[model samples]
Target: MAVNEIRLSRLLRTSKMDDSENTTSFDDRSEAYSEVSARDCLAEGIIGLLLPTVEQIDERVKSTRISQLELRQHIDTLAEDLRALSEKQQIPYDLDSYVKKLVNAKRRVVLVNSILQNTQERLNRINQSITRENERRTALLEPQVSTPSEGQ
Candidate 1:
């Protein structure tokens, strides 16, 4: 009977140790899961912030492109008017100043279009970078997402 009690005590102690180990393992996994959840939340927040800004930038780029087109049309119209005035009318006292003004406007349009093109290119690069980052986030998240489902 004493031997049997000793064996039972050893079995109880072993079972308790197993339970303790399981609890520790569960705690460690739960902490890791919490950390991963926090990382996912942060990534989602960053995506939310970045997407809207990228869309706004795209809208601005389109608006600027339209403005460039309008400016080109204006330049063409001014050139035509100047050509007709020179061809059919006597040179007026203010003609030189008027030509100078048109030239200045053309120069300003060219400068603005150049700036807009550069800005559009930069925005494109930024959008690409954001897309790449989103893809990377998805890649990081996919395996974590799949493992539990696969186990189930």
Candidate 2:
């Protein structure tokens, strides 16, 4: 038998012996008294042994609950940090898009400026050609008039 069972049997035997010695009659009352005392002692012993284990279990449960709560708080903080980091990661992409738009606009402006320069150069060439043609016509007309006056 286990130690607790041996101790409980011993306690029952001692209570029966004490009751038989104190009472003259080995009646039902004496048997009842011994049984009650044995039961009481057994209950007290069981409670005594179980109390510390119960207390230790309660302490462990409390610590486990505290640890679980701390882990949840850490997870919440990490989630917030992850959200902030995600937002920060998008900044480079937004900046890249903005820069691309600016570059496209600059390219359009440069293309327009090149077309305007070509058109201005063509207009200047046409103006010079027309001025030369007008001067040549004036010189030919003046020489023809002088030759007619000298022949007469």
Candidate 3:
């Protein structure tokens, strides 16, 4: 059995040598193996490069969500501030309406001023006319009052 095993080992070694000697295009096969290995290495390197970018994109997305939440909170705070300011200033809720109301109030003030000026002018004219009429009446009565001595 030992002799057979030795013979088998010798046979295997000789067969391998024979196969190597008989193989054609050995360089071509080696070149093909090297090309496949190089391609595998390049693929692994490309995947390595892409993995960090994917992770960075994930991080940015998470940060964007946090930023959006902060923006929402800021907006809510601004709205509350606006409400408080409106209450403090006795302003209307809608800005457009408040502006309109102010404009209308100004117009009304202008109109009332004009009316008051007109009424004042009319009163002054009437008072002047009354003064003139009183002076004319006094002039007419002075002669009648003076003639009372002629009858005596």
Candidate number of the best lDDT: 1
Task: Candidate 1: give the clashing pairs.
Answer: none
Weakest lDDT window of 10 consecutive positions for candidate 2: 11-20
Q: TM per model?
A: 0.70, 0.42, 0.40
Sorted by lDDT (best first), the order is 1, 2, 3
Best by TM-score: 1
Better of 1 and 2 by TM-score: 1
Better of 1 and 3 by TM-score: 1
Candidate order (TM-score): 1, 2, 3
What lDDT tens digits, residue by residue, belong to model 3 across residues 1-152? Answer: 54245334433433343344645555554465457446644654665575556556545555654555565556456556656677777545665455455556555645655564565565555546555654664465345434543444
* Residue 65 lDDT, candidate 1, scale 0-100: 77
Q: For residue 44, what is the lDDT in candidate 1?
A: 68
